[model samples]
Target: MWTKYSTLRATLKLHENADISQYGRLIAFLKNGSKNHKPKKAKVLEREHIQQFLVEAPNTKFSMMKVALLFGV
Candidate 1:
């Protein structure tokens, strides 16, 4: 098992004043999970399970930053 961190900076995108969603969200796309951001979980058996877990992780900490998540495999 490994650990990772979410990118509060990249998701914030301070460089651009992009328009947020009607509910206030970013439209930027990412090819992979953020290198710094990842979700917490117990041991897993498959990679697919990792993907699913990360997707459902609630942003309990940075609930306001709209941070992007990433993981280490």
Candidate 2:
């Protein structure tokens, strides 16, 4: 919707020489209407999972990533 609105706005400005400032209120409304997105929570590894991962990680193809995973966890 925002993309379509932007395209329509650009078309009007280019073809009709319309002043976009007239739609300030509508723009504000559209901006506020799209702010309902919620952020996702980060997943945490369990202590047992971490222990098992450390135990088996050394021999895996991704062994080099163990240090990075340890720091990230």
Candidate 3:
């Protein structure tokens, strides 16, 4: 069974040959948040999920700046 993450990596590799650097950044962001925030799963994340992350992130005991940087907000 293909896990969501494996599917995502395969999809990116198969169809997204351009903008490799941007994809690299996205992959890295999914794997590890900027310096403080916990990592989030990009494979199944939706818009609502992102919003939730943004909302709950600040409350965590991490640098606010780090969360902002992670989201580019």
Candidate 4:
């Protein structure tokens, strides 16, 4: 959504010569407003789950995916 907003702003600036300064208050609100803000709870993986993943990931065809997941985690 923020990306779309930035694209629109850029397009308007480049093609329409829009007066985007008039939208400063709106941009500020979108950036700092609490209305749509929600904290996501982190999901905890059990020891058994991690062990099973380690055992099974190597048997799959997605070897690169397994490597990426290992590094990412």
Q: Candidate 4 overall Cα lDDT vs. reference?
A: 0.76
lDDT by residue (tens digit), candidate 1, 1-73: 1121124444545556532332222223232334556668897558776566566656785434334434231
lDDT of 2: 0.80
**Higher-TM-score candidate of 1 and 3:** 3
How many residue pairs clash in all the candidates, one count each?
A: 6, 0, 0, 0
For TM-score, candidate 2 versus 3, the one ahead is 2
What value does the lDDT take at residue 13 in candidate 1? 53
Q: Per-residue lDDT for 1-73 in model 4, tens only?
A: 5666778888998999985647888778777764677879999989888768877765558677667767995
Please give the lDDT score at residue 25 for candidate 3.
Answer: 62
Better of 1 and 4 by TM-score: 4
Q: Report the lDDT tens digits of candidate 3 across residue range 1-73.
A: 1256567666777898433435566667655744565557678767787667766676656567556757788
TM-scores for all candidates: the values are 0.23, 0.43, 0.25, 0.42
Better of 1 and 2 by lDDT: 2
Using TM-score as the measure, the top candidate is 2
Better of 2 and 4 by TM-score: 2
Question: What would the C-alpha RMSD of candidate 3 be, to one decimal place?
Answer: 16.0
At residue 70, candidate 3 shows an lDDT of 72
Q: Candidate 4: minimum summed lDDT over ten consecutive residues — where?
A: 57-66
Where does candidate 1 stray beyond 4 Å?
1-44, 61-73
Candidate 2 global Cα RMSD: 6.7
**What digit string (tens of lDDT, one per residue) describes model 2 on residues 1-73?**
5877889889999999996758788889888988996669999879998789878765567676677777884
